[model samples]
Target chain A: MSAPEELTVDVNGFQTRVWRKGSGPVLGFIAGYGGLPRWVPFLDHLAERRTVIVPSLPGFPGGERGHTVLDSHLDWIVAVRTLMEKSGLVGADLAGSSVGASMAAEMAAVWPADVRRLALIAPLGLYDETDPPADPWAQRADDVPGLMCADPEVWKALKAPPEGANSIEWPIEQVRANEAAARIFWPMGNTQLAKRLPRIAAPTLLLWGEHDRVMPRSYAARIGALLGGRHETRVIGGAGHLAELDRPREAADAILSWTS
Target chain B: MKLMWFHLMPYTELPDDFRQRHPSVWVDIHSELFDPKRAHLMYNDFMDELEYAADCGFDAICVNEHHSNGYGLMPSPNLIASSLARRTTNTALCVMGNSLALYNPPTRVAEEFAMIDVISGGRLIAGFPVGTPMDTCYAYGQNPSMLRQRYLEAHDLVMRAWQEKETFAFNGRFNQQRYVNIWPRPIQQPHPPVWVPGGGSVETWRWCAEMEYVYCYLSYYGYKAGRATMDGFWNEMARLGKDRNPYRAGFLQFVGVGESRQHALDLYSEAAEYFYGRCLHVDPKWATPPGYTSEGSQRAGIESQVKQAADSIVRGKSTGERMAATARDMKGIVDNGYVIIGSPDEVAEQLREVAVTLNVGHLMLLLQFGNMNKEVCRFNTKLFADKVKPLLSGLFSEWEDRWWPKPMEDNLRAEIPAFLPKLAAE
Candidate 1:
């Protein structure tokens, strides 16, 4: 399955950049904050098996500005629904990364019939206020291999500015976004997601990076245990929070295999 | 010229009855002690101690990070630093740091460091450590072998993030972010001074020397074990053709003071034993786990320790016995230079010798060790500052001045642009 070539949708007050490709059962992808259009490589592979829809989230470069209030969960659901309807996707397999993962969980709870299956990679929204989230940007910025992959050389090759900025600015922006998100979802953004998980009817697969400093893999088991539906959780070895970037093939394979 | 007193607030003397009832009870010493109610008390006491240190003429006070361990009670050193920021007046709040590799993105460190630096009114010595294998590899799940690489990258990213004026992209192996921009930048223009702490790693020595960073050798074992490490560093500096600048080098030692050496020993022996036996036991596995320690570090640490121990045995010496005896003899352990426990005068004299011998510009005294009582730790700290510090300050001042001469204004000039950007008419 591959992502769609073009799928425009209104977000906040502007048209957002969304793409869809392939021709099978539709699969929608919602990316994390600051995530761009290029992160849809997995969708390209998934497109080989199914139709994929990917949206450039609001406030992200090349995407529409987010709402003034910027309720990420509500905005994400609206955007995904808008993309699905625009792309003629009645029902689709949904997946998201970071903040996007929270949206997927929300959608599964609120619009259960719309999503057939769920794939969440290092999902946010379950953070407990008492137990603080590990800020991966601060902890592992200097550690290229630690942040990206187990292999130093692999990290070196993939090393480039995140998307819109250069190496230095990327971390700063990431920190700001992380803090903003953390503030928005207090106590544990994902903890509430876990509570509402029983409402989800979709069979869910949770993918985590074993080296995920952002959302430590310690929470994976708890997240899996909470879902009432058939739930599977797998750790991608040698990968950090952005596991797809670190181990793209392995991440894609996990998703593809699961969907198949 | 700045002085900072550091203490790891450990539960030194658990009551005998408590121990009898709780032997091997897995008390979750770190979490339990920090559980809100107790944590508030402990933190308040620690803040008072630090404030006392400041009142006693110290320039700064320090705290550090550890995990799931009783050795150092601080799991989040920043929390301590933050609290100190509000309470402290003239003292610099030093957090040895949040281990870089254990973090994702690594910018969270940049942000927090910046925040703390600003909050402390530029009174921040941002300490970065690659971290010990036991802490880094076991607790944080970082591969020790790749620890250095991760640390280096994290350092580079944070530095760039701090210094860069414009929004930029950071595409690195580990961190990928677009629109790199940070608010509330550090109060210091080019960020704060960076201090790297190590325990006698050759790689650390070379890197510190190369980077011209303040290399702090935490001499937990005392001066004897630290002698070779400091010598190795000076030798490396010599080979690099850099003058032996004392300001670039620092040493940390554990100190306990009393009316006499025997009194000090009596007071600290049990706590020292707990530190060495219970807290310091590296679980061999955590110390040198598979794919944890780097090949270079492995060669220097485990492999070298093994070879040296083997050599001692081959020479028909009492190798095992010597090793075991060294482990048991707390005073010999300190005198041999792992720790330094004595009266104020004795500790002062010892520190002076260490500074002169090692040509160390900075001396970081761990006033608290093992589970030493908080009151005892505070008293020792006051005694050292009041009695000991004044005696040695003048002895090293001339050396410090000679080696670290103030920078000439011309030499310190900034490369400002001649042309300024014009603003559009509002």
Candidate 2:
């Protein structure tokens, strides 16, 4: 098992970090809040067959500068589409989790021809007043990891600072990553994303964690019903909102088998 | 030296076990805990206290905004300032002030502030605060990432609205108005002096220095804890080649004056304990939103106290343990410089040193804090005015108070008829 390679590609002067691994069909992955500090078991499993291209969601971690420029959801959609083009992930199978998933869905809907097969894992951007998504933004820094994964300690270990990292810059960058995502999906995750969901023409897979607390299993049907193309739902057992982080192999298989 | 009376107007009747039972005192505090019936009396009492402070010879009376907060109830300080404008003739009405970003179109702030200035005969010290993360981000549902951008843009619009005489088409990223004409313009030329209340953000010091506004530090912890932030402001002033006009700065302190040192402790211990222990019982989540503090200030360790408070919560430091550490007893409270309590002579001497050392012309004192009854608040107000104020008056007499409000002269002021009978048409 080779370690994933890190590369920084400039997009319209904004430096975006993209992680590259494995080989086959290209699969672009975007992780959730505080973005991915590093690749998880999820990306590694997906990379077993596919050439995984995981771009840090703009303004998140490696894409820190995007926070200043991105504004509305339209701004986010354009930024992600351009980032995909610049990272050489254009026309690749797309998969996004949580906030990244929200951005992925937006890209597919706005620029339908750019994405091949789309996989969304408990994505946000839809708000139902009656049974609204549990707020992911208003969380304490320490409790955030626990909310994202079934086994909090597993994700916590992955997010813990690596050796030789500057202590002050480390926590600041971590918080700033959230700040970046927050600019796009702050206050409420909804940006009338429901209105545009019907425009997504790509074959879609709606992957959900059975025990997902953030978006919940109930939201799958609401999300699926609006899709314009062929779509199906899969539930990963013993997983939270981020099924990939909790049950990586199962999640990877879920995306691979469906798209294949 | 100018002394300003500031009231935090906390809900005095939170159940004795509030910090124990409630998860927080702000943002998401149980609404059922609030007693509106009690609030009716509290509001009137608070208003009376401000008016009384005005009569007591404090140079200014201040009120500020906070949303869904326990300790500070003035969600709309402009409303309070309007009432004070009519009631108090001599004192400056410092509505320190509307959260710039929260106002939609932000010209609303300009219009309302102008009205207050007109009604108050031009005695308005405008305040532009970035507001706390809890107030702006959670309670008011503002995006923390965009909050500073929105605040700066809103400020530009407000300043232009106040100064621009011609109807202008104002276009900005956060706000847009086709006709930016504010009626009932301020009597003061250019505008009322601006005061920026800070929580030690490094950027605020630079902004205040550049704008020539008073940088007021509103701290729950007293002067000892504030020296670093004040020094940071002075350093920025020097770098910008601005004069050390002590009037360019303001500092808030929690003070208690009694017949003796022991009597002062006995007089204020409960209120001080309530303020420090209960009013500050915020949920850690609401304290520091991501991007709420700038990277520079966060790196400079200016926002470290807020982070430390959050860290204490994460450690599951029980309320008993936390309270026992700081404001559990009066001795701990006074020692930590959270409150300055002593006889009039002692308090006067202490405050004189605070003004001189901090180089602040405006001394905003929190006389009415926590659930303190009106009687004790008035007692403190009267004692400070009679004994303490005189001692500090000579401290900054040399410096010009460039930031104080400039009211119109008596002969130049507007005069309506003393009484008007009912209209014949009515």
Candidate 3:
């Protein structure tokens, strides 16, 4: 596989960063909470199969930050739809992880024509009060890695700033991503996406991390059941939330087989 | 040089091993630990102490807001301030005050504060604190990232509600209202003087300086630890070209006035221990939630707080140790200036220096703190009013206090307390 192409697009007045590579079919990917600051091995693996397009959710890692004030869930969803359209990923097979996964799944639900096939890895939209998921926002900064990943060291390694990037600005960008997410899903992670799940008509794949502490495997089963059309659950072992970062090869294969 | 009587109103009946058993005094502090019957007594005693302070001739009587905490019992400080408004006629009623973000519509705050001001005949120093992370974020579920934004929006809404004569539609990001028409308009023209109580937030001093509001530094760590925060405020004032009228800034300090140094220690030691050891026994996790402090504040030392807390976990530093709380003893408290304790003359001299050095005019003194009994709190209040206040009132007398509440009558402090503590024994 050749080098991934870095690009930028305007999403509803907000300038967002996008990355594209590989050939075949267009695979529009939305990144997880720990954003794709650098091209992770997972993206490299996924790129081997088909053309992959990943847009930085506004206020996420590479996205323009001063536009952190995305007011509500509707605003966020519309912004995601714009990202899909602007990145030329309309009608493409779509995938996302964690909060990104939630946005991807919502795109299929609310704007069904935007996403042809859906792959959501540990999506964080549906919140169960009886068996609540761990609040990623509430965790201590140092402890967050251990909470989200099977091995904390994997997260530390993934967070290394790409070459030619400001080492100081890298951490600041990550915090801005969190701040943006917190704006939409604060107090708790519930976006009431369960209400809109039945609207999704696309064939969906719910991939969950076996060791995921943030959103457990139970959430995937619930999400699979809630999705409108045919959907299946696949547990990627030796991983946690945002499984692609932890078990990139395994996560890539699961998505390629199910969605590609 | 206006002296204000402030009370934290800490719960009085935690067991001797409360800190050992409890993870924190805030947020997850067990509900079962609170006994309403005992709180009933504590509440009345605390109220009596404030009234006594008013009678003892403090310029202002103050109460503040906190939630789900063993440290501060006044979740609705407006309720306390409203009650104080009715009971005390002369002293300014300072509600240190409602956390603007926690209230919905923001007009709720404006309406309630107006009621307090009207009831007090315009003696209201409205404190607009963004609130601590434990209170606003955890207890009230205000998002740490948007807490300040919500607070600022609420501030704008509340100010507009007070100043706008006609009902107006408020369209805010966090809060909205179809019509904001507040009844019982504040007796003070436009609104009561705005006092923003801040702790380690860089944006607050800038905001306060821009708004020409009083920036009250309400740090529990006393005057020594308070210098940096106060200096930051003054520097911002100087840079902004705002006059350092002293009243433009307020400072809270734990104070104890006794016959001598030993007597002061004997009087305040247990309460200081209880306050520093138990009242501040916050779990490190609950202390600094992410996005609670801004980037500028993060640089200013909020990061150091989080870093210290993380190190505290590694070093297994107790709450007492984390705060450098002077080892929960009177001597350490004095050494750290966590509490000012000495004879009336000594305390007065030291406090005068604190006022001049920190350049703060509105001195909100914690004469009643921790689990001190009502009698002692009154004794401390009366002693400070009689001795310490007179000495310091002359320090900044040349500068006019523009931020004070212009009351209908400032004659409230003339009345003496029912009884003073017995000083001389046979």
Candidate 4:
């Protein structure tokens, strides 16, 4: 089983990058900020059993920047919808990491017609007044591995600093923009997601890193509790915020099992 | 008693519309603020803030590290310390510091501390922390089982780099270098004073005692909460045949002041709520990760929080209720010996009591609480310096001469590598 040809589509006035592979129910992937664009490698191991679809998000690496002030959730949802229509995708499994997980949750909540199953790996968006806030930009790019895994050596191995095309580059600007975005949404991100969790009709699986310093696994329970649909929470041992990067085999297996 | 002020530079206000379109505003609170350009500006402002603290009569201004998180905006405490080294006159630059075990060579810390000490004219307190399980074992991907060992090794390596004068070869299980040499040696003889900050870990106490380092318990929960842990430390110190001399130990407390206790409590209640409720909310999985915290420490922290939550339920306490209900008992935790929050008179009186009770010489005041407005923090800081410091200065001035390290000749020292015998033979 091999990946399909790379496909390009216009989504919300942005040139979006999309790729498909294998021949089963379509599985859409939403990546966290700074994630590699080549989703084929990530899905290559799973392509044997199912088909997968991954799109490069706007303003992210390899994707065109859309509106500067547009809502990220809406932009992503619309982009995924546009990609699905262009690629002739019907019902598919959905998976996302970090910010991507929030988008995946939103997609399942608002457009249940497009998703049959969903998996969120160390997903974000669940903010309680009692939990610590995750600041993606405050960290040195090299320090990310540490933030995402339980084993320092593993994090050290993954410590490829974001650079050139792959790098977000303007960290301070990104941080300020994020802070502004957070204030604008107030509690909507939390309240809306909590409200829409009940609307997610598809089977859902929540994967969390046991050592996730960013969005601690405690948020996993809140995520599971809010999503009124059938949901299971799996905590990946020795993983951090970026569970897939930290413990790929375990994360991939969890996703494959849920989708299958 | 030496007084240190702790500040966590947090981006308090977020732009309005940014929160809406973002997928997860909760997690991304400070990401946008950390953009390269903004980070440069924030760093400058943060440095200025710390410099201001120095000018306000603080003995030392502290900074620490956190990543991909808004709680403590400093990812590189060294950067801030470096800046403070040039900007401040007398205040010591406490890097409270780089997680030694997280660095590959650990000598990077040695070199950096040496550089900062020279830059700051011999005013530097080198802090070597094992780091929290969340920080070390999880964030840095260190083996939790070997975290303590790794930390100790790193500590030794850095210390050797500072104390030894000659370039040498070295090898170790975690760090290996053909030639070991650190430039720009520290001005403080035998290196600046070493301080160890712990979150009530048993291993940390023994290590501090063995090393004869100042053991600073950064009590976030408050004083009463750390009683058992402090008692355990004292017992260990006794076992090591160390005296109950207060100069050998210190504790950190969060203090807030206003015109009256009612005003102080009301003004600080929101910040406290933010700190405990929003800032410290750790998922049970992350908080009690498998093998992250020791069985005993984990059990104790959980039990304490649970008991506090249960007590809150029975008593109908609104303050700290939302956050406390989820975890351990925090009541009197700070009061027991960790924190003192009130008006100047009240906080000073409590400090005197805590110093007497703990029989300690140093008090690290976390003057800045979660998202506390700058104006308020400045006011609180001024009040403490004016009213509180005067009350306690007399108590410890005489002992300073007896216990504190005397001024030493400012000069570069030799460096020592891991394999001293091999280098000597060569």
The candidate scoring highest on lDDT is 2
Per-residue accuracy of model 4 over B56-98 as CA lDDT, tens digit each = 7877899876654545677678887887776665676777777
Q: How well is candidate 4 docked (DockQ)?
A: 0.02
Write candidate 4's Cα lDDT for A74-146 as tens digits. Answer: 5545665666667555577889887678767777888886788899987666667688546543343455456
What is the lDDT for B100 in model 3? 92
Q: What would you estimate as the lDDT of candidate 2?
A: 0.82
- The fnat of each candidate, in order, is 0.00, 0.69, 0.35, 0.00
DockQ of each: 0.02, 0.63, 0.42, 0.02
Per-model tally of clashing residue pairs: 71, 0, 1, 64
Q: Which ten residues in a row have the lowest lDDT in candidate 3 chain B?
A: B311-320
Model 4 chain B worst lDDT window (10 residues) = B312-321
**Candidate 2 lDDT tens digits, B1-426:** 889999877889888899889988888988898889989999999988888888888999999999898888889999999988887776899988889999998988888998999988999999988887878999999998889899999999999989988999988876778888888788888999888887766678888887888888876767876786687778878988999889998888999999999999889999988888788887776666667767776666623544664222112121222333445567877997778889999998888888888888898999888778999998999899999888887776888888888998868766643332212212
TM-score, one value per model: 0.55, 0.94, 0.92, 0.54
Give the TM-score comparing model 3 with the true structure, all chains together.
Answer: 0.92
Candidate 1 wrong stretches, greater than 4 Å = A1-260, B1-3, B12-36, B301-335, B399-426
Off by over 4 Å in 4: A1-260, B14-45, B294-339, B397-426
Worst 10 residues of 1 chain A by lDDT: A135-144
Best by TM-score: 2
Across A191-226, the per-residue lDDT of candidate 3 in tens digits comes to: 999999999998999888889998867887788777
* Per-residue lDDT over B1-426 for candidate 3, one digit per residue giving the tens place of the 0 to 100 score: 899899889998887898789888888889899999999999999988888888878899899998998979999999899888877877888999889999887789988998988777888989998887778887888877778788889999999999998889988787778988999788888779999887645577788888988988777777877786677678778888988799888998999999998999999999888887778877767655556656555443434454663222212222222443335666676788889999999999999899999999999999888888887887788889898888887778889888888876556433434343323210
